[model samples]
Target: MTESKAPGAQSSYEARKPQTRGRTRENTPLRHNFWVDLKELIAIPDVASRLKPPPKTNKRLGLRKTAWCVFHQVVGHNIRNCLALGFQLDELVRGNFLKDYLQEPQGALTTAAPTEDQGHEVPIHGEINTIAGGFSGGCTVSQRKKYAKGVMIVETQGLDLTLEPDLVFTKTNLRDVVSHDNDPVVISMVTTGRKVHHILMDQGSSTDVMFWLTFNKLQLSLDQVRPYVGCLYDFAGYQVEVRGNIQLCTTFTSDAASRTANIKYLVINAPSAYNILLDRPALNRIRAVASSRHMKMKLPSLEGIVIPMKSNQKDSKRCYENSLKTKRGVCSVTIQPPGED
Candidate 1:
């Protein structure tokens, strides 16, 4: 391969270099390594047909040599060093086409790394307090560990709002003038589409009661009464007789806001200060709170707004005075209508 040249001058490439005959495979930059030379692999009829030939070029770069690529069927390079051929073979290997022929060890990472797409879920960096209290009320371990730990073992998205935000009471809710604590929450409510006054909302009582006198005054049919199998308990002063209970549409209104529910009233034959006695059950049903000091009953309406019903102060004092008179046998129990308690 030695050729004579002028002093300090480079010789012609063809004269200085050994003749390759275009047969030598260029070192493949592609990373695909196979158990055998790709030239030998594509010998199979199926592989040969699938193999894509590199672009045909009639013009040779004046290299007077001959070496044929089986894949390209051209005189340039071997299939092993062909960039296009190597890439296609790597794709076939990844598709499990030449599994046994691959240089990558069995069960090794041969495929390209997976890319994140629309299906991949991103980590949501947020938490919600579905359970307010934890193991301890004071949150002994601080807020999270404090209260109701026995219940909050597993975190979860819980109940679909069976309750609204808790309503609170304030000093402004108190009566403008100091009223005696003896004042009762006696407000008017609509029942059977008629305004019924002297309805006492009492928390101490265990049942919602409508005296037989008011029951008759409403002109309700006896057929509407369903047989109540429960035991009857009498209030102080009279032996109460239990009439079958009836469900009535009773509405508590505070100006524009109102709440109405079919209340199952235990129609009782007894004399009391009020026409309708709403006890704990009724108060709870309407989600109401009665304060004698405030002289008003506040309840959440259907829309979750607080509605305030001011107690009839004049009627409340009258009932209190009459209650004293009744204890002294001054007021008769026969006319136990409104303002008699």
Candidate 2:
């Protein structure tokens, strides 16, 4: 038997019916796009490379019937099938990282293939046939050879290529250089204890050249030169092999003082009237200043005195005439091999 209730008290079914008196409305749920957001985030250039693979336990999860892509965090794919890798590679190429590496030309890549002389095969940059073996997908000979070749190319680009500026000028030098000059400023210098005349002071040339006839007359032996197998091109667009470089002590003397430098002369087996061509290196070493108006050169001596060497105008004109004659005579001269000369 229950006690009698108060007049204000309500039953549970009667209270619920009053709360539900307002009619029920239609349900509108929001759409979840987790996979799409994840894909976009992974495709970001900076973020693509840093994305790591999912944990092994997550990879082996039974949630998906097939594999999963950790990058997109979606099923039915993996990191190997990632679409962001192609975009990242394209970005690297456009940014010049790949262009610089592929464009450098100084490095020599040698293949293991033997020649008739059993010499090391030099791999040309673009020729695929020069590879040691046929191209295939595996840890094969061709792949290893190519890998080694690439490594050598990268290693050769280090400190050996660095060069410093050679500034050889002074305030007091070239104070009276006049404009509109036509004469070539040629001077004399001592090479290997002998006075060498008709030495052309060529500011345009990049190398110190010694003609074969003059080099032979100087009595310099072949063994004294370090073998240089590179080619040198002249102003007339003629290409020839640089025989070698022989080091010599070149001296410039005047009434006041004298200067000496160990100059490396590139031996060129060619016909030229000039005995020696004093190019930028020798001039820079001596700190020489040339003046066509004055028809002389001022060089800094070891004793701190400036020595002025007078130019040989007569010899310069004679050499110019001789060179013209030689050029006219050999208009269609055949270039022979180095050994044939």
For all the candidates, what are their Cα RMSDs to the real structure? 30.3, 24.9
Lowest lDDT 10-mer window, candidate 1? 332-341
Clashing pairs in 1: 134-147, 134-148, 134-149, 135-147, 135-149, 136-146, 136-147, 139-146, 273-341
After superposition, the stretches of candidate 1 with alpha carbons farther than 4 Å from their true spots are 1-165, 175-178, 235-238, 325-341
lDDT: worst 10-residue window of model 2: 115-124
User: Candidate 1, overall lDDT?
Assistant: 0.60
- Checking candidate 2 for backbone clashes, the offending pairs are none
Number of the top TM-score candidate: 1
Root-mean-square deviation of Cα positions for candidate 2 versus the true structure, in angstroms: 24.9
What's the residue-level lDDT of 52 in candidate 2? 39
Please state the error at residue 167 of candidate 2 in Å: 14
